[model samples]
Target chain A: MALAKRIIPCLDVDQGRVVKGVNFVGIRDAGDPVEIARRYNDAGADEITFLDITASHEQRDTTYRTVEQIASEVFIPLTVGGGVRAVSDIRTLLNAGADKVSINTAAIFNPELVKEAAERFGSQCIVVAMDVKDLGDGSGRYELFTHGGRKETGLEAVAWARKMAEFGAGEILLTSMDRDGTKDGYDLGITRAISDAVDIPVIASGGVGTLDHLVDGFSEGAADAVLAASIFHFGTYTVGEAKDHLARAGIHVRR
Target chain B: MSKTVAVIDYGMGNLHSVESALRKAGADRVVVTDMPDAILSADRVVFPGVGAIRDCISEFKRLGCDETLRAVIEAGTPVLGICVGMQSLMTRSEENGGVACLDWLQGPVTRFPQDHRDTAGAKLKVPHMGWNRVRQISAHPMWNGIDDNAYFYFVHSFFVPADQCDSVVATFEYGLEGASAVAQGNVFATQFHPEKSHDNGVKLLSNFLDWDGSC
Candidate 1:
């Protein structure tokens, strides 16, 4: 049998509570990170990713505590993204029981962090998360964005993924800012582009409105894994249903 | 009777996850320690690692954990190694320009060939991340409750070639067949991370805790 494609439930955690906003607005508390993670684990999620959306520096330790609590009970791989900046930050997160740390803003500002973090922590735990916005410029190009897709970096998404791979990133978390919260679907173009450009696995994120979107990610986007927030969080679809759908679609998934 | 499982900590990578998993699997007490005395005195030993082999081996030597591990194994204590910890049990590794290992497993760890291609002629990714099905090749206590073709979480670039080893208890396919788990006497090791491998992983950890280190 081949490696089964992963279906990861993304929890946008703010101040230790799970939250999901529409287009980065209208944020509402979903539940506690630990409780929500346990539910997802029971639902047979392949992995759990917690994007620490906590903004205050004083309250940042809450995320670590939340991660530690979940890791104690959740047996699946836990990836914490959103504010990973330094190598020490990665260390603290891993020590707190996070299986992997996703770096987005830091990688663009200081590319060396990726190299050094991978060298120190191993590439398996270093995931380079990229927030991309389709230019719609008819040039069929995607640009990288930072600050939760508020600011643009003008760098080509495909080339950046390749560079991150060369710099020792084990995986890429590619998100589409355009389709995010739109219930449209993943921007398969950029997802496939990044997936084809890098030999490392790419986790397609954002705009997963239905279970079929997950299958499209693996088949059309060539993603090794797919990530969604609201669909699974709001009880519209359980992770089990997603896996069954993918399996029926001829995609191998852990059931 | 109460049991203590010591997860060797040499500042290599995260040991808390393994410690928690072991505790959840029924270990009375789990200690994540770099101290040799505590490790040797524990009822069970877990050697887990991440990152490069060069650094893992160096830390093992610096902390004298290697020597301690040898003594623990000689005393017939059940030992479990995960990921790089499994690689370090080999004779040598091609990682970091060829480094000598503990030589307990009798094989060399080699990187997945850069040119290794899938059926589509596309190169398979290194670090073979995510869940892959593991096929049991031989009977072992570790597979007590685990299925024949159970899926396990694997993440690594280097692996022990299955053909070079005779103690292989489980195997998995990436671009090539590789040893997923091996058992010899009191020591059982796996390239996959059981602590991160969901319920099946919990079953394996529970089995290891109950294992008497026999075939």
Candidate 2:
């Protein structure tokens, strides 16, 4: 059997609670992070990702406690992202039992943080999450955006991905701001471009409305993993159904 | 009688996942420690590592866990090594310009060949970072209740060469065959992360806790 393509359910956590956004806006409460994570684990989620959207410093400890509690019972790979700027942040999440930490805005500003975090923690745990929006110009270019896809950095998406991989990023969490919450599908062009460019694993995030989108991700997009939020969170589909669909479509997934 | 399993922590990488998994697997007392006295006296011992092999070896040296580990194994205590923990049990590794290992197992940890392709001609990814079917090659206590060719979560770039390892009990293919699990006397090691592998993994950890370090 080959390496199974991963199915990661993304949990947008705010102060220990799980939230899901519609098209990156219209926030809706899902449930407790620990409870949702356990359900996903029992339903056969390959991995669980927690995006800590805590807006304050004092409540930051809530993310850690959430991670600690889930890790104590979930028994699956846990990835914590959002608001990770420093190496110490990565360390704290890891110490709280996060298997990997995703860095987005920080990597664009101080690329050295990617290098240093990878060097200190190993590339396996340093995931550089890239939020990209297609320029939509006739030039066929894509620009990287940070701050939840509001501000554009003008940095080329594919090049930045290669640079992050060079800086020793274990994986790239490529989220298409344009397709995100649009429920269309992944940006296959950019996904394939980045996946082809980096030898490391690429996890395609955003714009997954159905299981077929996941198949296209691996087959057409060439992504090593697929991350989704609302579809799995709102009970549109279970992690098991997603895997079953992937398996039936000839994409090897954990059964 | 009560059982105490010492999870050797050398400040390498995350051990809480491993520690909590052991507890969930029914270990009466799972102590994560670096003290030789604590490790050697335990009913079972677990050696876990992550990141660069050089750093792992250096930390072992810094903490003087190298000699302590060797002594614990010699005393016939059941030992379980995970990830870099498994690689560090080898004689040497080709990571970080090559690092010497504990040599408890007779082999070298090497990186997957660059540009390796499977039958589909697709270039296999490094770090093998997902669930892959592990084919059990030999019967061992760890395989109890686990199906042959069961999937486990793995995330690593280097692995023990399947051909050179006589003690390989399980293997998985990623363009080229690599050792998934190996056992020698009281020492059992796995390249995958059992703690993160869900139910199958929990079962394996449970079996490890019940293992008497025997075949």
Candidate 3:
């Protein structure tokens, strides 16, 4: 049987609470991170990603607790990221029950960290999260962003994705800054590019407003999975509804 | 009394999630322990693992769980191995520069070709993540209530070949046919993570719990 396309609901957590924002700004509290995670788990989400957006060290500890609580309640695979700087950090989250740890800024700072974590924890548990923004200079190329999309790395998105895979990243959480929260759809161009370039699974994140967007993610983008936040968080579409739509569209999804 | 399920912890394995899944699967007393006695004394044992085979073998040996596992298997106690747990059951693995395994199953673990491709000529990813259907090859207790081609979650780069065809109970297509589940006498193992597989996973775990180690 063909492997089913995954539907992942990403929870942007701040201080232990799940939050949502537009264009990575103007954040607003949605609900308790654990509650939302449990809801998604029961609603048939293939997986859940908890992106800890908190900046302070103390609040980061809170994110760890949030991850622990969510992992306890959610049975599906959980991916936690945001401020994952070291192998010890990954170990802490994994010990707390996270199935995979998403590495972003730290991965760029030290690509070896990806290899180290992958070697130590198995590449299956390391997810390299790439935040890509359109160059907008008519180059039609995308560059990587760090610090929650606040800074640009000047590294090409597709190349960086391939590098991460070479460095032993099991999966790539590719997020499009241009399409994030716009609800238009994923940046299919870059998504398909990276998906084609890497031999590891690619999870398309950002800009999923409707079920069709999810279908597009799998079809046009060739993504192995699709991740969204607001659409799932605010009831714009339930996880079951999205899965049903994908199933109807002839995309295999776990029922 | 409900069976006491002991999940072997050699400082590896996703023990927490496995323990939680066992509980959900109706295991009343699930113990995550590295203590060899705790493992041997349990009614059933779950050998779950993740990460590198080099570390897995070292830890398995260092904790002396290797000898304990051998004893449990020799005693015909029902044991379930997941992922690396399943891989380590084989004689050896090409991973970690050719590490030796438990030799419970007469086969070698090999890595999926770096350029592995599906029948459609499409490139397939390694560390085959996500859910895929498992086709049962033979009737076994662990197959109880699970659909013939039910989907289960998987995450691994290397796979154990069904060299000992008699032990293979199920197979899944991922560029090539690899053993998804293997069974022989009182031992059962799966490459997929039943704990992470939701309904199908829970059902499989529950079946393992109810299994009497009889073929």
lDDT tens digits, residues B149-208, model 1?
889999999999999888788999887899999889999999999999888898999998
The sequence of per-residue lDDT tens digits that candidate 1 reaches over residues A79-107 is 99988888889999999999999999999
Q: Assess each prediction's global lDDT (C-alpha) against the native.
A: 0.90, 0.90, 0.87
Candidate 3 regions with alpha-carbon error over 4 angstroms? A21-30, B162-164
Clashes of each: 0, 0, 0
Docking class for candidate 1: medium
Worst 10 residues of 1 chain B by lDDT: B115-124
TM-score, cand. 3: 0.95
lDDT, candidate 3, B1-215, per-residue tens: 67999999899745788888888889999999989889999999999999999899899999999999989988888999999999999888999789989888888889989877888887788878888889999899899999988888999999976554457899988878889998888999999998888888999999999898988
Two-chain complex of model 3, DockQ on C-alpha atoms against the true structure: 0.66
Would you give me the overall lDDT of model 2?
Answer: 0.90
Two-way lDDT contest, 1 vs 3, winner: 1
Per-residue lDDT tens digits of candidate 3, residues A1-255?
Answer: 377889998877778766663222222334677766766777888999888878786667787777767766667899998889999999989998899999988999999999999988999999999999999999998999876578999999988998999999999999998888799999999999999998899999888888899999999999999998888766777888898999999998988
In model 1, what is the error at residue B39, expressed in angstroms? 1.4
Error of 1 at A55 (Å): 0.9
